[model samples]
Target chain A: MAVDGTRPYGAYPPGSETEQVGIMTSTVTILYFAALREQIGRESQVATLPAGGMTVTALLAQLGQQDPRVAGAFAAEPRLRVAINQTLGGLEQIVRPGDEVAVFPPMTGG
Target chain B: MSVPGAGVPKVGSPEMGSPELDSLGAGIHVAVQEAPFDTASEIARLSALSDRTGGVGLFFGQVRGGNGLVSLTLEHYPGMTEKILHALAHEAVQRFGLLGCTLIHRVGTLRVGEAIVFVGASAAHRGAALDATAFLIDRLKTGAPFWKKEEFADGHASWVAAREEDEHAARAWSQDTPPPA
Candidate 1:
């Protein structure tokens, strides 16, 4: 079960000084959906974001490099949307450790 | 409106309930069921929830008789289903200044003339509500992970293929211009 956490705007709430310099550490959850889920063969997984403030696009690039299946699904850009926590966000959205990030194809539900 | 021991959340449980109103709030209702739904009551529920809205647009999708086909079974990836619906609902809210919305889709065995899906939207005027309702339904049919298996009257069954037109319909919404009427 994905626990519902209270992170506004899918990012960490503003202002908290807990920077771990040079450690490159943060626990995060990743969610996949639709054809992306089918291609990845897994719906959800936990990962550690690269240190030095990773963006949604960079994280996706990393996933693509790690798994050819994921790379194939994201071969074309702008076909997918990233949401942090639960709200829709842009590719520039900053991802932090312990944040829940979800990547899905363009939505098609009522 | 209720199912026992299905592990599904209740209609107004806090974890899944809306804070703006007594039940699931004035806008949006989401449900997944195994049995047939009563169209009249569903419509009434949606209408009753609408407030200060000038129009209510409804889309009721039904199983069709394809000569010998008699029933259909729907399947979905559970966790993904909820996540996708929640995301879609948020988009609908943003796209249209909707007063209220409702989505009810039935899974498992369903026969012709039975309701397969329902989408309702309310807005200050007819245009937004009507367009948003259509957009939501079109997107849901193509985007969601749900799949249908049709059963013929002769006991034959097969998975329904995804239509390219449906994908096009969904993609059209991403554009700035309105779809043709």
Candidate 2:
């Protein structure tokens, strides 16, 4: 059961941050959707950020280095958008630890 | 104007303890569900939400069968989608001084020609209602978080890219959408 009644779209796995980041507190739950999700082959992941925080652009650059699929997807679709904690934001927005970051292609819904 | 589902209904009272509305009247209803919404019922409900409503405007979008499309799959960010949709609907209601409004967007896989999204707004005059309706849908296309993937008859499926024209439409409305006259 999801924390909410709705099905779990994506949630952090149990202690996923600890497992990935070891002792880093600068970790965030990252989510992908649509074309980006399909390209990345994973719906969500917990990633460790630098000590303080990083901009949405910096986070993508780091993630792309860790996984080239991220690079290719963003390269193929240059219009990828990002949101911090479910709020749509620009690439320059700073993403802090424990924030939920979502990266996806342009919205086609109405 | 007597019984519901009988004769021409009036924009009158909601049923006792109706979840859809209350004595104060529900100003907005936003649904991001899988099942298709009844466009006619939604329009009627919008008008019935208030007695001062003189006109109602509706916009419905159905999937197109062109380009050998078989079905379209809609994916949305669950927690984020509802939040953004309600915010959009609330803005539409307040901005247009609408009496009430209903906005529904369907998810899951849908066949061609199926209703994908619908928005209806009621107001004192047609202008407010129509402009609100247009504003709601246009903003939703660019603002909402739903994504669509089209499945072709040849077993090839592709995600629908956001259209530039949609951005222009939303921007146009933001510039100077007049109030009710």
Candidate 3:
């Protein structure tokens, strides 16, 4: 089950000074849907972020590096949208601990 | 005027409790389920919900055949999809003066020609009903958080890409679509 966390994207107050500088890390749940799921070969996974946390864009970059296929898949399309806790999110959205992040292609549902 | 099957349980009512409406809210009913739904019964239920309803317009979207298509699978963001559908339905009811609205979208593997989605809108006049129906379907295509992937008889599968045309269709409704007299 995906954990629900408070705080919307871009609303994360920079963590306490001690928590910054990679002193503390947070676990975030990342979910894949549609083609991205196929490319990632899994539905969801837990990833640890650097102490200060990272933007959705940076997380995607890090995920891409971890899996070249992910990098290729995202690099192929610029329209991929992300959601934080099921709400439409932007690349700059912050991903904090316990947040469920979903990345997928533009919606094709009717 | 009474609809043919208006006696059926109204959607979201105690007798008709469905996963569609986790919490009974007024005027809008949304379901994102994997099971096939009875379109006639759903329409009947929607029509029965409001005494002032003059017409009920419904749209059923089915999987298209061809392109060697064997089956199609739909995936959605669970919690978000329901919220998004509710938002769309609420907007339709307000903008089109609808007495009630119903939206049900099926997920999971589905065969060609199977109903993939349905939208029903009830209003005091045919104009509102008809326009709201179109608006709901158009907006649902692009606004909802669902994705489709098609599999071919030859064992090949591909994700369905969002079409520019669908966005255009949804956008058309944004400019205050006039209700036909």
The prediction achieving the highest TM-score against the true structure is 2
The C-alpha stretches of model 1 lying farther than 4 A from their native spots are A1-110, B1-26
lDDT of 3 at B23: 35
> lDDT tens digits, residues A1-110, model 2?
01112224433333343244434466887778888887877777777777778999999888888888878988888788898876899999998877878899889996
lDDT string, candidate 1, A16-38, tens digits: 21222113256567766555665
Evaluation by DockQ, superior candidate among 1 and 3: 3
**Per-residue accuracy of model 3 over A1-110 as CA lDDT, tens digit each:** 22223323112222222123223247776766778877766666567887677899999988888878778878876788898876788899788865667788889997
Instruction: Write down the DockQ of candidate 1.
Output: 0.10
Candidate 2, residue A85: lDDT: 72
Q: What share of the true interface contacts does each candidate keep?
A: 0.15, 0.66, 0.60
lDDT of 2: 0.75
Interface Cα RMSD of candidate 2: 12.2
- Candidate 1 lDDT over residue span B65-175, tens digit each: 977988876655344455556556657766787776877777666788788888888777888889988888988987665667778877777656566688888889988
Candidate 3: stretches off by over 4 Å: A1-25, B1-24, B175-181
lDDT agreement with native, every candidate: 0.65, 0.75, 0.75
What are the per-residue Cα lDDT tens digits for candidate 2 across B1-181?
0011111111234432344334223577777778778887888888787679899999999998997999999888765776677667767776888888877888889999999998898999998888899898888998888899999999999988789999887777776555332
RMSD of 2: 8.6
Clashing pairs in 3: none
Which candidate should be chosen as best, given DockQ against the real structure? Answer: 2
